[model samples]
Target: MTAPLLGHMMDVPLLVSSLIAHAARHHGNTEIVSRRIEGDLHRYTYRDCETRAKQLAQALIALGVEPGERVGTLAWNGYRHMEAYFGVTGFGAVCHTINPRLFPEQIAWIVNHADDRYVLFDLTFAPLVDALAPQCPNVRGWIALCDESCLPAMKTPVLAYETLLAAQDGDYAWPLLDERSASNLCYTSGTTGNPKGALYTHRSSVLHAYAASLPDSIGLSARDAILPVVPMFHVNAWGIPHAAPLNGTKLVLPGKDLDGKSLYELMESEGVTCSAGVPTVWLGLLTYMRDAGVKFSTLQRTVIGGSACPPAMLRTYEDTYGVQVIHAWGMTEMSPLGTLAKLNWEQSQRPPDARRALLEKQGRVIFGVDMKIVGDDGRELPWDGVAFGDLHVRGPWVIDRYFRQAGGTPLIDGWFPTGDVATIDADGFLHITDRSKDVIKSGGEWISSIELENIAVSHPAIAEAACIACAHPRWTERPLIVAVKKPGAEVTREALLAYFDGKVVKWWQPDDVVFVDELPHTATGKLQKLKLRDQFRDHVLPTAAAASEQCPMEPLDANIDAHAGGGAHPVKSAATPD
Candidate 1:
């Protein structure tokens, strides 16, 4: 065997600290704006942020935080939280971002699982922290992400963030560490059982940022002011924190105010040109804008992910508001950026309908990621855009294993099997059909719950919709639409079912429409289908008798309570679309 030739390039490690240092040196004057928890906008520069981050590292070191120790945070997206992103990771400790929206017990379980040495929180989460203090025995202490005067009352003694930083001089230099060292720890939104952690290394994080900032991905640049409506705790805000600094782009962190009016005000006031978040947040913003009769001034584009974006929502943003909607798809395991739906020149020049159809897909993979669809027999499927199968992906940024090796190896033959069932066109565009667990199998045919839900919400009268599997005597399980009506809108179940006649195949139409006051959602803004399935497991359809002539079933089950000719509670007037 011949020995490999060595390159003459320098071998500098790619640490998180280097990103902040580079930003401070080159883009020192760029602004990092944040709507703080104190109901006021806070502004700073990259240079200031870098200095405080260094001071924070010094403070953590003074508190005996050792290398590779886990540091937890339960706060909104703001300046202090941003500092912790670089400080803890830069100083060789792991930054574990805890989602505050999770149940207190779940949060405690996650904190204990990570064995967090210190938990920092905003004043808004003071009560939550107090509630979780006794449960999380592994947490050493709690630090409030506020000044001394603004500290909130809590059962346990809390350290003041500003006070801790004030004691340390901002002269500490960032330490160089191995690029493969773990830098960030983010847990999946444990919908099934206990949450599993995805530990990210400095190398993976840096590579993900570079790929995500490319022209075909998030497309970040210095001229754009990017607001990550996606929370910092969610896959590191889909890696925007690192990408923004790397690209010298102005960063705007929306604190806790994710409402439409607040987001509009922030974007207009900050001159934000690009933003990113889940479909639910954008739906709220679009609804608010339509009602207020306003338009966007500086916002040009947005990246919607975390769920399957509805076609109508994408149309509204582009046709009505002039904002380009870039549909994205990924999971917590893939550094959450597998594919972005950016059109090539050839696809972009197609007719409006054709272009929109292509945009509706999840788009193509970026450079580093490789994806393919496989069948149940473990054979790879053809990329014919029609034959859908289990989607599998593997890349540099993808996780080799979970934090604690939870379910043994999560990869099959070197590829991580994403829980999604999808199709890949010849051009490499990935179109997600449904989640493996959420896809409905009726009479041996696969029906996409996501497609059904999208069609249900496309109706003007429907606000939010969820399609879940209901037990059927004839077909093992059938699709049932559980929807919430828009405020002041009147639509009957018959009319709503009729609206889907031409949109989808006749057999794919839901067996029944059940109006609910609201639908449940997971902490990360995903539809909680598991809960819905449990709630209506035995719901009987009106066509049960006709579908199965031999067996006759009652129209309503014992658990079902009638409300305005539909199952479950009566529809509430004020319910809004997700």
Candidate 2:
């Protein structure tokens, strides 16, 4: 015991500014490309980015931005936005990224909630800023993220972004911020109630960036060029902005235009080696490529999240385009990086189909995250892969409390309940069955709407699908599927019902199917199942009618004709929904 333990290692604080500083000093030549809203490519190097970021920080200070105050950015991903990210945080002010996709009221509410004094917005959002300025009374001024020539006319007093930057000298000193000081603020999508802020600290952000750049994670490096199609406002673009700079990877930002054609051209021209986006964005790109008969030359991989990645989409990318799709799962509360679907040596050696099946599950947790499943009685379940329960997570980056919320605990013991029902296999793979709020309960048994929707959308004729609970007389509630067919693809309700044959239990099947032109989606591209549930609240299932009258209108199989295309491939079975 006397052999004194080497008194704890150096105590350098993990600050957000250090990431950019490291990039400038070591990887100064790395390029960052942005597609401007004016439909042109703007390019710069890390050194230039650092210089501009310092200028922006100086300008913000000159504008009376105080340390620890929140500076908001209501813009798309671009060079100016990146500069704001480092500038605000580097100068010890919290950078709050407001989602422009939210409704105008929500945007104003978020700004007011964060107490943001100033907002830096893109030219494309000038109209939006004009509309919100009246509602957001606390906002002192607005800075358009464009030069004087490009600045749009606004009703409020606006300052040109370049003019402000040009007024300041690049020489500036960054404050030595505490490691635990708040760095950024992002509000949840607020599907249920008013939006709540998730305040991120410098320590948590830097640590998350390091974990995200790990080989098993997003795997950023100097040799790679990453295009993050996920918006900057969404969980800090899933932490790609920080990870890219920390590892000195080339960054490509797509501004104001996420159309498939625009994205394809940008990726091909930039020589992007990898990209990340939600499944809907990829579906658009895939559809574009299929129609154009074009393939990527430099893109080697993509990370799909935000929603489940359809098995068909994964197969199409790998089998047709020679691109590897890495499945990832996260939430705004978890610093947006939880688990990445990278296979280990043992798993990589498995058969192709087996490996694909494994990838279908949301992979194991990366370092810095701890996960467990708990049953109804609050007992921790074993990782035997057979038991499903409420998913709970705790880690350096997971949120302990939402900002400004009073008088309630959001944690159980030390773990945050994720509100997702999932099972962890012996090998540590996480299979998410459904969100707790969206699961259907029939005859006191749980049915996963997510599972049913995944199966339904896999059919070639079906373009999108959503399942919601409908009232039933006997079962209390039953699943009703709302589906959108591909243009010109005629898929009948009976044929769709027959497609589920043998794939799921007979009673577990949807009681009825309804075809709709489109299903509603949240601002972030997730299916708004709550809206669908509301739309179908008064729907009466045939089962309810049969139970009431002792006779059904018609058998479910009546008029069912074998469709031209086969049904979806069987997914690996999981624990029966409770």
Candidate 3:
């Protein structure tokens, strides 16, 4: 190792394999703990996991799993999944993660599209595989990600994951391979529509994980106990599992059950210091803790993403829960993590609420992430907060393009043009106004659905709101506001409309309001406005936009005529359930 080229860039092989080798070589006793058979806990150290992974790799090769063949895993985040993360990919096969939450058709399509030749699934998802196995041609066999006793009683051919590991030589050596070889494939969250697979090379996944581990990003260390609440199938649980082991962090997995009671118990038992998940997960945990009289004396911070965080939601965790919630922003195209909201030390002294307010905005871009905002005309916009524009990002770990999307263009001039419309202030905070598709266009002016949703969540009675653009036939498109009232709470459209007063421009208000049981979410937990639009496309208020145009528009209500601003309110009409 002649003067190991310090500061010089090393590719994915050096980043991934070398780190595991070092861990097995040095910090081998660090534990990788997980909840296995529902209530039962399973644990393994880095030394055990690495050696098992080596054995698994040899087993895969012996089973005729060709290099570059897509190896699918339908397991929860745990020691076994972590081992497969290395075994399949480290041995030169592509790892394809199939989300269990997806509709059966979508799941089948993803697995088929990726040409998965082998599937390693937890016994929990055994029924799903049994039902779909007949349809999946490329999947030659199934490997149960559990011990022999936990194997499902199914007629389909199944191999016990642990049993197979038992038969392998623990000392099998890793074969030398090119750093640029394909390593993993993850599809976009099919929220808006169909999914597309993003091919990750060994070089790309390793690089992205490193950037995520940096201080300005996740800053994971061996001293921290990291729990990933996000499912392993979701962009490799935002790549935390891989990054954590590389940086020697103590890893904890909340397998199978992700509810608050289970997670809280594990966090306390494991002394988990850090966790990452979506807003919904925290919502349940906070609710459970408040009701169950539980406390996390050691839990310090949480990273929340998948959807925007309401300022109020941020306040609860930071003020009431004693846990810091750092809002992050990203897409599947960016290897998932592009921005994190870990504020600087100076701002750390701010009051809890003030700090929570800062957490609402997507914080500064992380290392290896470059962002820009451009208007509809493709010209770059100033960073001034008022000029909200489409966000574009280009980074080393971000997707250059999708896999096998024959002629599709996912990247523009080397930049992965993020469809989010956000504004970056001089201080580097990102205030995302809306998604390009969700922004309602009233007479060519944009109305942000995200703003309405954020504001709606602030109302005492509102649980959630989704503002969808409805065809007006005159104004092109107007907002259709839908709210799901909190349990046993009476919140009419009139009440929600009143709550929005003075907070946003009058013209930004939805022309029609609807109360619904729930707002649909995509597979990744994002609001599905496209589905909302399709659901309500035909049903529109005939007189809503017309009234706005007929009256004299007010200053605060840009599109409203003076008389229009004071015209018959949309709430007076019946809330459209359709």
TM-score list, all predictions: 0.79, 0.78, 0.75
* TM-score ranking from best candidate downward: 1, 2, 3
lDDT of 1 by residue, 43-151 (tens): 9999999999999999999999999999999988899999999989998999999877655777889999999999989999999988999998778789999899998
Segments in model 3 whose C-alpha atoms lie over 4 Å from true places? 1-15, 345-356, 438-578
Quick one: best TM-score, which candidate? 1
Cα miss at 100, model 3 (Å)? 0.6
* Pairs of residues clashing in candidate 2: 446-578
User: Candidate 3's error at 57, in angstroms?
Assistant: 0.4
User: What is the Cα root-mean-square deviation between model 2 and the actual structure?
Assistant: 12.1
- lDDT (CA) per prediction: 0.80, 0.80, 0.72
In candidate 3, the residue pairs with backbone N, CA or C atoms under 3 Å apart (3 or more residues apart, or in different chains) clash, namely 551-561, 552-561, 552-562, 552-563, 553-560, 553-561, 553-562
As for TM-score, the candidate ahead, 1 or 2, is: 1
lDDT of candidate 3 over 246-327, digit per residue (tens): 7888999998888878999999999999998765466567667877877788988887765554454566676677887777
Candidate 1 lDDT at 31 equals: 93
